[model samples]
Target: MTSYVVSFPIRDTVVRSDNNIPWVLAMHSNVVSIFSCFRRAAATCRSISCNTGNDLSLWAKERVLAPYISSERRNRIERVLENRTRNVVVVLEHLHSKGNENAVYRSMDALGFQEAHSITADEESEAGQASGDPRTDAGARKWLQIRKWHTTRDCLLHLKSRGYQIIATAMNNRDNSSLPVQDVDFDNKIAFVFGAEKDGVSDLAVEMADVCCFIPMIGFTQSFNVSVAAALILYETRMRRIRMFGRNGDLTDEEKRSLLVEFYVRALTSSKARRVLQKYKYDATDSSMTENI
Candidate 1:
């Protein structure tokens, strides 16, 4: 088995160690290390909780990168964090065009949505294409959790298991079969499924959906662009959420802190810093920490 090592910086003037060197944590075989944050480093200590391996990884990354970010930047992250929600998610089924997907990502990120799922049963590369428009999307890809599944059933089933109401976006012609996006209740947890560009929603996806939603169109056009529809729907949902729970909605302090850590980590730009961050992302998923423990 191959072992992985994780290292992070410690401000020299504030943190003192052997020869004033940076802090390093080496994990091998069954060994792991945990470090505390600066404010409470003296009292806090490391513990080996096999179940908390992923969480430990998060904390470790936050510890290393959080201090480097400015207070102004942190405040900006906090403001966005309040409006963010896991209550609603967007899903795209078999979407081939990177442009459409990137647009949806931009809209989702703008509305403070934290996750998006895709069922690319036919095109496996759709998920990877999100990286194609980093500049255009303004790096929204870094902030959102995008998941790709192989089948519509698999994606819907997983969302259902999480207690999300799967709402499929349907065409205008499907009158009785669909409701206006605004008419649908945004109070409940929803996973909106948008189909491919050519075919729209899959038959199976439509069947599995808890409800079908359509955007109202007055003109001769049958539908809005997939990306446009996504923006409109998310905007409506955001407004509804705000109406119900103020602009900040129901996001908790813990949630804000978690997102702050992630956003702070992502804000790092130097080549050396990015390389370290990459290791943190990869090693964070070490399944052995869960299965073997």
Candidate 2:
């Protein structure tokens, strides 16, 4: 017997076996993979697939959906908005596990980090899609900005241009070059890079990093799981920010309003969203006319 895998773009995944029976699955982000088993007598296989459309900007979509969301839902979105921050970022370098990737996203969301970065040197690896498993991510992927790069050097240069200090997580400090996680100044914009689960941080990433840091561990276990380490580091950073600033850092008012629109759009059904968006466009035009008067 042989099995074939087909991927479809629908929110609800439907898998058809050799008998052409469809198996429906819960909606999830990323390309859905389905397996079909065939009898040994069958020498040929058929394929079915679909392409998801281009991503729409959250800011644009939000403008259309803002008025359709309930006040309670709006309030919840506002709460998320109040705590969201881009001041600190995490960069996962060549992390191979989907669960670990999702765990990191969940941790970042819990600690209110708005953006993350990933670097994968291998051109043919599925590591690029590590963050695509929404089942593991618990919907945290929707709330955070994820950027992927082909090389650590490119990622470092990009972050540096945006004034982010690159910090790599290492097993131990080299000479006097690295800082203790506790001592790193959380007030500054920083990008913390954690390496693959087994390899730790790569030598290239370490070389490109402006600072190298590690969590002080004790007892028989010398290291924490990558996800656990990220959570600990982010939690520490979040607490320091709250203590020093009297509150967790937040997005700007304009940013909140934009994201509010985005959340509203995402919550509505596609048909309702289209109607709401049209109304929003007309309302904006009318407001502009009144302002011109």
Estimate TM-scores for all models. 0.73, 0.70
- Report the CA-based lDDT of candidate 2 relative to the real structure: 0.69
State residue 138's C-alpha deviation in candidate 2, in Å: 0.7
Task: State the displacement of the C-alpha of residue 186, model 1, in Å, after optimal TM-score superposition.
Answer: 1.7
| Candidate 1 runs further than 4 Å off | 1-43, 46-60, 126-130, 172-175, 271-293
In order, candidate lDDTs are 0.69, 0.69
> What lDDT tens digits, residue by residue, belong to model 2 across residues 1-293?
22334445544554434443333343554432322212211222222211123223444345346667677887888888899888788998888777888899999988898788877766624535733577777888766777767888888888899888889988665566777798887777899999899989988788888888888877898788899999999998899889989777577786666556555655665576565556434232111111110
Per-residue lDDT of 52-94 in model 1, one digit per residue for the tens?
Answer: 3343444556666766667788778877887788788899888
| Residue 228 miss distance in model 2 (angstroms) | 0.7
Question: Evaluated with TM-score, which candidate comes out highest?
Answer: 1
Kindly report which residue pairs in candidate 2 clash with one another: 62-261, 62-262
| Backbone clashes counted, model 2 | 2
| Clash count for each candidate, listed in order shown | 0, 2
